[model samples]
Target: MAPLALLVAAFLAYSVPPYLTFDPALSRVPAPPGFAAHYGFLVAHILFGTIAIVGVILQIWPWLRRTHPVVHRRVGRVYVFAGAIPSALMALVIAPFSSFGPAAAGLNVVAALLWLGSTIAGWRAIRQRRYADHRKWMVRSFAMAMNTLLSRVYAPLAFLGLGPSYPKLGELIPAASTLAGTMSMLTLLLLSQWWLDRKPKKPAIAR
Candidate 1:
């Protein structure tokens, strides 16, 4: 997970600078004409989502959780209120106008809703002192939040896998990207469940 997180951080370092620059010329996907607020929403979503990812790393660290439970709880609040909720809300606002196509838009919408919903569920569970449920739901929330990184990871792989066989690569890229997002969500969901069900190995007895 550390290596994967470092890789994602590297990807963000490379990919996020243009958006931060606030120059439309550097925008990866320009705001559709007539929707002036789209760029603002996109930037907000990116920033908050980045925060949520960082929070996840710290929240899940065994040393932090074990040694500093109070800090963990405080960070959890920030992750919920300052990061995931805002990012997911902004995602809802922007997803319908996706440049890729309606399919991509729909996928984004679903992912955002699930991300928002799972995070909320986790928060509620913790509030009610249902620690087990909280962990499960938070795992799901993390998986949903990670869709951003996973989708980006999948896009290039999809291109490489499909480029040679498909004659009209340009036309297919949008659909392929949507498929990649779908696959990312599904893959992450499965992994999250596996995590939830995993049991710690018992220590071997000394003979």
Candidate 2:
């Protein structure tokens, strides 16, 4: 239920119109100085990131994995080979230009690294028949991929929550954006790992 809601919202928000309209604040990227490479990476990142998010969402659904094994593998391939890897690589290229600041940029770099690492590790674990490890690593990877949803949240929350004080604090808005955005990313990363690591209770024997 949660994944469905989140994936849908992500596609609606960050996936398309925002990129086409290209609002600096809403898109969370400052305008590049007419550079082609920047535009290339930005578009690639958004397009593939959307694919990764949707792929991860479907891949995590237990029913799909159980009922459609072939589809699950296909989606998993799309998530990794065609989506996450390229998106993460392009993310590393464009992260430094984050309008939020250096802190936000650094957090993005970390997110990209973990996103790629955990995804690849998950793939290798599956190949080695370590299903548990595969699930664990994929959970972590999806959480990193969720930076798309989490990072977009902080700016609005801070700006709107601080609206009454906006006049006086206008100059500090950029710093506030960075602080809120970076903290959001870290909080999501930690929470996701914790959620994934919680042990399921053993079924009562002979009940």
Backbone collision count in every prediction?
Answer: 0, 0
What are the root-mean-square deviations of the candidates from the true structure over C-alphas? 1.8, 3.2
What lDDT does candidate 2 reach at residue 68? 100
| lDDT by residue (tens digit), candidate 1, 137-169 | 998998897898889889988777777776686
Instruction: Evaluate model 2: give its TM-score.
Output: 0.82
lDDT of each: 0.89, 0.79
The sequence of per-residue lDDT tens digits that candidate 2 reaches over residues 178-197 is 65667677887788878887
Off-target runs (Cα >4 Å) in candidate 2 are 10-15, 18-28, 160-170, 203-207
Candidates' TM-scores?
Answer: 0.93, 0.82
Q: Candidate 2 overall Cα lDDT vs. reference?
A: 0.79
Which residues of candidate 1, in runs, are more than 4 Å off?
Answer: none
The weakest ten consecutive residues by lDDT in model 1 span: 162-171
